[model samples]
Target: MYERKPVQSWLTDMDGVLVHEGQPVPGAPEFINKLRSSGKPFLILTNNSIYTPRDLQARLTRMGFEVPEHALWTAALATAQFLADQRPGGTAYVIGEAGLTTALHAVGYVLTDFAPDYVVLGETRTYSFEAITKAVRLINDGARFICTNPDVTGPSVEGALPAAGSVAAMISKATGVEPYFVGKPNPMMMRSALNTINAHSESTAMIGDRMDTDVLCGLEAGLETILVLTGISTRTEAERYPYRPSRIVGSVADLMDEI
Candidate 1:
């Protein structure tokens, strides 16, 4: 068993560890409040590329969470930041939603339909054949490919929906080029979050539910990881996996108790 240590900062996964289907896990708010009261800094790190920081803050607040806009970090934001640093003012072919487009534009990327320098792939609920074809043509012409994350699907009340990874994989199959993933299980997103908070890896703990993405990502980044059971992962499933978190708790409530 891994012993718990004193952590000064936290990097939390939003969808599973904090809430589920727009509902806060039991005692989640109080748990977060306790962290704040204890003077520990935390940021909600998520691979979901659908929403901007302000949008996520509103959604979480409506769900009874006291999340501030600055406390949230999404893959979309990390991708935009990366693009901004690598190819500022470059034209991009976006196969994503308004949130992604907004982030890119905010970071000085130009949106264009012709001869784009980059092809950014993300989830689109209303993805059309025309859009896919256009993106493929751009990639075929040698545009750099970038994907928000590699998650095949996202959990929802109705079931799973095709995520950015699935769409990016389809495009890669058509163009014979793999995309550079910018989300969890990749170290870039974690680095971006740490830089955002000016926090060091040793002092930060990543609280999440999924072992493959969340816990593994944290461990790979050398951050302490805490696994919660309120989302896609169960204790039984975790036992069967090779990657183990630094700690396991029943829920966010249990996490608060341990911390």
Candidate 2:
């Protein structure tokens, strides 16, 4: 029998698993502290590409969790790494905020609107009609399309707002070209995260709140997946999925003793 090794490293989602609605879930801070003190390799992952890791670190700090910048990973970073690998020093027409722009710039990608190599879409609070129109025309001309994630809606105090996935769909409908998603639910994102921390699948566990993105990505990456019920998917909702996680827990607080 080919048995897998025990989990020595961890990857966890941020929104649902650790924090929800701009607040830290109960015991979330303690769980992070335990991981930090134990010297385990872990990354706090998020699909939101609007803010940089430093910005996220500051947000988490305000929520009473002391997460370092290096321990934070975003879809923007993964997408940037993918683009850099696919076409080093390539040009792109991007419609996103500081996070996405910063990552692409760091990877030596030149952002432009004139006959660029790719049309990269990411999350942003302000979605301009002119920018979307430009992206649509650019893709129609010959640029490849890439998106950071497939999340259609994002939560806000007001309600759910259209996100990058929604905008990508609009552009696709207009140009008849689909974007290549590089975030959660795509194993590439998980692989990039693992590579960032030099962690192997056999000894790593992925803890997420959603069955679709987090659990699916982790499973596809050959890592043990744990679904926590602190966010989106409930135990009943999870049962409807075709695939199953390695285990289910009520919250991150439940796994504190293991660390």
Candidate 3:
């Protein structure tokens, strides 16, 4: 067996690992503070495209966590970067919010339903039937489809709401077109994050609570993965998957000395 070296760079999921339901998880603040003080590059990754990095930073700050705006990496950012690389100055028909639209605009992507190069789908509080219909029609007319993440449902103050993945499925059903998801569970997203932080997979570790997205993404990208039982996934549930994380811990609290 090849001996793996100690992890240097870190990539962590935001919601489950660091905070839960907009509240800071135990020891999350200290762990983040350590990462910041250690002079190591780390990013709080999320598949949620509803809010931009600044918005998310504010949300976290309000929750008593001190994550900087630049420290947050979102699916919206990854998706926009992918689009800009694939087709610079491309036009898209976006069915998302300011986070998604702003990212695309920053990359010189124009939002239009008219002869668009891509029919982009992202997280939105309100999935307007009119907007979805326009996206479907645009795809049917030869627009390539793209989705931010594969999560079908997202939690709201009230309850679970229909997310981008849910609407993407509906559009696929109508137009017989499947979207290319650019978020977690996609190795592209992990590689893109690595590029952003200027880190190598061999020395980086990914910390997440979900096996399907965070752990899987890191594993596929050839990085060591740590699963924390602080959110959606339990130890028993994680064992059911064929893919395994390098380590399992109770929460971010336990990793205090590791950093």
lDDT of 3 by residue, 136-204 (tens): 888989999999999998766687887888999999999999999999999998999999999999999
Worst 10 residues of 1 by lDDT: 1-10
List clash counts for every candidate, in order: 0, 0, 0
| Of candidates 3 and 1, the better by TM-score | 3
Ranking by TM-score: 2, 3, 1
Q: Please give, for residues 82-176, the per-residue lDDT of candidate 1 as tens digits.
A: 99889888889998887799999999889997889999987677778899899999999989999989999988789999888888888989999
lDDT string for model 2 (1-259, tens) is 7687888999999998999988899999999999999999999999999999999999999999988899999999999999999999999999999999999999999999989999999999989999999999999999999999999998886879999999999999999999999999999999999999999999999999999999999999999999999999999999999999999999999999888
The CA root-mean-square deviation of candidate 1, after full C-alpha superposition on the true structure, stands at 1.8
Q: Could you estimate the TM-score for every candidate?
A: 0.95, 0.98, 0.98
Off by over 4 Å in 2: none
**Model 3 regions lying over 4 Å from their true place:** none
Q: Model 3: what TM-score? A: 0.98
lDDT of each: 0.87, 0.95, 0.92
- For model 1, the superposed segments whose C-alpha errors exceed 4 Å read 1-5, 257-259
Sorted on lDDT, highest at the top, how do the candidates line up?
Answer: 2, 3, 1
